[model samples]
Target: MSLGFAYAAGFVLATSTGMLTLLGSGEFPPWLWLALFAPSATAVMRARNRQAPGWLGTLIGGGALIYGTLVVQSQGASGVLIGSTSGLLGIFIARLVTRTTLKHDLQALMLSLLIVIAGAGMNSGVSYGISFVAYAVSVVWALVTRQLVEGAEREASLPFGATLEVTLARRDIVTPVFFAASAMVSLVVLLSTSFLFVLFPRVGLGSFKMAQNSGLPDSVSLRGSPMAGGSGAVVARVKGVSGTQIDRGLYLRAATYDRMTRDAFVRDSELVGLQRSEWARLAHHEDARQYDVFLQPVTDGHLLVLG
Candidate 1:
């Protein structure tokens, strides 16, 4: 049961991490704070060998569905998504309170995964990455414990008229060796995943963010110092196309300057949008060097090109 509880803790960790991510992304409703109590309450009941009544679950589910319907008029399309997830939230909580059944556990796990995937698409920050890593670790831990628990249940299957009683300190099951083994196994899983991530890189895991800017200023000012260019951070990486060889030194144009000053080069305040027809009319030279430029995300969405 201690091992089972440990697995439950992992389940809670993964679910909570996912919910927090969704909340941060503004995809999840703020009512998540109250919804969290269901898992916490279920965990407590699981530890005490108690099951919440069936009617209570029905009431919770029904109430959630009703509330979701009521908010649809005010919230619009997002309200519909919120309402559906909230309804499922009740079902998820209901499953958590039930006895150790794979159906119940699997359903809850999948639901948590749904939230996690949604969260992954919504945010691209260090905190979200940390949460995802923690979620991954907890998922691994939960899966291991879940398998062990199922085997234990099968072995200790109770027949009619037979009551099983278990009384043992946590230290008996959760020994130092158990923890050491868990840590090593977790480390191995993390390292393996990290290695694969580095090798294949990003392979369509999440949605593409529309934000294409970095933390640089939109307009340049030569008011301060004579120095040009930005802090030594990389702006873009260039690679030659076909069999073409890149020159050792080349001037990469970012923005064109209309006027030059003793202090700094001044860029035109009024900029015109380049139309498709205008781009097509430009002269095309066969001898012009061609290279692929991979630019990093920046706050200033400016095009950096090599001539």
Candidate 2:
């Protein structure tokens, strides 16, 4: 994919995720959403063309589908289709409007942002009654002025990995000396700023504003997926009370359901009530027994290695 379209798709994912949190029923926390976005976008960006990879499609499309299902599963196909379509449309439009042959990375990034804002604004649901429209418009206009209206012939930005391949033999000798001096000056300035920031007195302006409260959010990191050809084995190992060893498998969690509207899970409730606690207690009892049978020096990564 072109850099412009790649960036545009990333922007759409971010925007859709944010909007879902803001306007939908249940919620996935921002941090988890960010984690999800990273791999999902990377998969989409790096996916081989000709025939798009199933893993890429599953990660990105499945995520959006899950979000849609959470929002309105009960609302039937209409609700699911609308939410899913909205996300898919954002990507489709981004790919359609971007030029494929842009050379510069910075320029491509700027152009991608421009495309996102322009495309987003065209969506009445996104732009309507939003105070940030002016900001979006100004950003778009500035890029057009710089890259298009101004007629700058700057080289299209190259991806970092590809840029590293340039041979030093191509360098002009005088340019090296000039660049060295510039680098020294830049290093000194950076050190001075760092010193000042560290030594500067920190003060809090006495103004405190409460953030708007929202729903409980959770996410599964892209570390593993049992449905995606995984071994579904234990992620961690454990030691037991006796001379026994217990692998981190054989335990399963019940599915969690979020508050549904239309076709998606819009809000997730905090686990509460006697029924919830009872379920938790029962699970705890089972885990306690499992943990008591593992051996020493069990390597479980960062997963909950229960004692």
Error of 2 at 214 (Å): 35
The reply for model 1, stretches above 4 Å from the true place, is 1-5, 26-29, 66-73, 78-84, 98-103, 123-125, 158-173, 183-307
Best by lDDT: 1
lDDT of 2 at 148: 30
How many backbone clashes does every candidate have? 5, 26
* Model 2 TM-score on a 0 to 1 scale: 0.24
How do the residues 113-173 of candidate 2 rate in per-residue lDDT, one tens digit apiece?
A: 4434444434445433242333333333333323431122232243432231132112332
Q: Give the TM-score of candidate 1.
A: 0.54
